[model samples]
Target: METILSATGLLTPGVEYGRVAPLADDADPVKAVGAVVPVQTHSLNVGVLTEPGQSFPDTDALITRLRGVAIGVRTADCIPVLLYAPDIEAVAAVHAGWRGTVGDIVGVTVSRLEAMGADAGRIMAHVGIGICGDCFEVGSELAVCFEDAGLGAFVLPGPFTDRLTGEPMDPDRRHIDLRCANVSRLLRRGIPEANISVAPECTRCSEIAPGPCAASVAGSGMTLAVGSEGKSAARSGVRLPSWRRDHGTTRRMLTWIRLREECPS
Candidate 1:
């Protein structure tokens, strides 16, 4: 079971992390490693774990210092963030959607980890695959919410422009940069710039276009129907079961992280 990315570089020497592909649900190996998954409710809740295999309800993030205990979150298009603090031996797995981003879930998670003696400056963060800025079209109101939250730089107005050509697009398509917003939040919390690594893959268009573009996936079954269908990943078009791409597909990608159990020599 090859993962999208091993993410070994994202953490210190003792932690392991990866984002699972959609097809591997039946044989997910992380569960065998004491994976503690939460019942996500798209909120700002963060669960603190003291043991492995414990479940939390309505949580979008999980953090723990327990060794050998893997914590994870499920997602379709929302961002999956993994954090580690080598100094304190702490780890966290976060699920950030538009809702969680606006509420500053990652910031709160960092605060919680700090409460456990972890230093924000030494914390390593990995912002995994999710909707990219250009592909994530949003309503003006939503854009304003991000702006109000001090994330105005990441918002692009309707009639989106081509990142490659700078050409204007549909008059009705405003967009927000979830990744940039999260990274901004991370930096504001004193997580050093060099310590944060963000995956470039966009769950929506990375698979559908040569370059990620929302217009490419707009009306395609790979995304919500443009006009009639509502708004909304994989290679060849989408390797994961994107809720927007699959049009309400129940399937999801599991993002997990664990502090490795010591190997006996």
Candidate 2:
């Protein structure tokens, strides 16, 4: 009997991306690889790559054709975009923070994948957990950044608050949705909408107070934020996100994808 322990349904049947969980001590999430998988993680400095290893540098994404080696990115309020090409057996793990979104990291990654013989129209993409637009309030400069990049629709008026005072804020300050922006990038690059999946849960709002973990909350469906949805959270007794700075927490969620070695005929 095949007892499915953790079935995320994120990847295809043969795909080997691990839906890992971070430690209870507020550390980065770790994959389910034993001492066998030749997996590698990067510092996720918002840069792109064609290699993988533990070199903690200024890179934010990784792409590789190496089988059995997992590549992952860490995030809290940032978007973790994973791409896979079944034709070429190539996989990519990207960390798309707000800055990365402005820099078109996801688009750049698609270009890199296309360079490696990956058809943008055929590749599968997944936009993982991060802050939602309603929860991610930003300054004018930050909001204009995405608008300048032709993602004006994603930049909307989100709930704004004084970061220092933690009080009600002006309704004018715009909030940016990194997930939507990245998705737009993928669409602009010719990736089919049917080939992409976006996780609808907001990192800050998904956590339930004295309740279920990410798996359970995700098992349900919710998308709220810290300050913006305080009343709702208090009423529902929701927990704060792991790495949500708004909740005064420090932790990261890991998103990974790997290419399994082809079997010998």
Candidate 3:
């Protein structure tokens, strides 16, 4: 069955957030939630929404202080980050692919939130599912981009084994941990370590439901062992979509966030 993995519980009381894997031809889930979603260009531009149903072109991040108006980003394998600042009653949804990460999109989002009367120390972040370092093999040029941006630690030496089939990649390929790179950005912006929650699933290897279809779609693979920073091991049998695994599949998982009209005491 189709499902949405919720992270609202990981955030403050007045926030709602989740990631949903839609069927190949399902309608837009953002519309179903009455939220605004940007037309992304894989750029660094962030849209600041002031009203319900607002959208912008070439936007990969979204921020809003409006109550009851949700914001979201669609991704196949890129990381989705949801942020909330209770003190300012503001929220942001960011889509950080490799290019966005190299450009420090999460850092840019946090700075924007801080400018809007938000305290970085009080902001809570939920880093959603994406391609894991083990599965994301890249060329040296892309790896150097992260290294030059001072995120070199998240980039690993290659001679990688495919996370799905355990086959060796080119010895010279490199892997980057997009999730931790963005987490480092959040920490650098002053959000406490305890204020962040990371989704441990790797979209490429996190299989769909168990069945003949799953058997056909997923291969025998080793599970990803996440870091010791309060993260769980990556599990299988969740229905999240992946552009890399599916080879340019149009299906996307929508990660969304909204502020509640009433805060619970």
Highest TM-score against the true fold, candidate: 3
1 or 2, greater by lDDT: 1
Against the true structure, what is every candidate's RMSD? Answer: 8.2, 7.0, 6.1
For 18-104, candidate 1 gives per-residue lDDT tens digits of: 654434334342443236889999989899998655779999999988877778887888988999988888889999999888899
Across residues 175-233, which tens digit of lDDT does each residue of candidate 3 receive? 99999999999999999999998877788876544322222222322111122222333
Error of 3 at 251 (Å): 0.9
Deviation in angstroms for 263 in model 3? Answer: 2.4
Residue 71's lDDT within candidate 2 is 74
Where does candidate 2 have its weakest 10-residue lDDT segment?
1-10
lDDT per residue for candidate 2 within 176-238, as digits (tens), equals: 888989999899999998888776656765542322233433422321221222233344554
Misplaced by over 4 Å in model 3 are 1-9, 208-236
lDDT values, one for every candidate: 0.72, 0.63, 0.77
User: Distance (Å) between predicted and true CA of 4, model 3?
Assistant: 7.1
TM-score of model 1 vs. true structure: 0.80
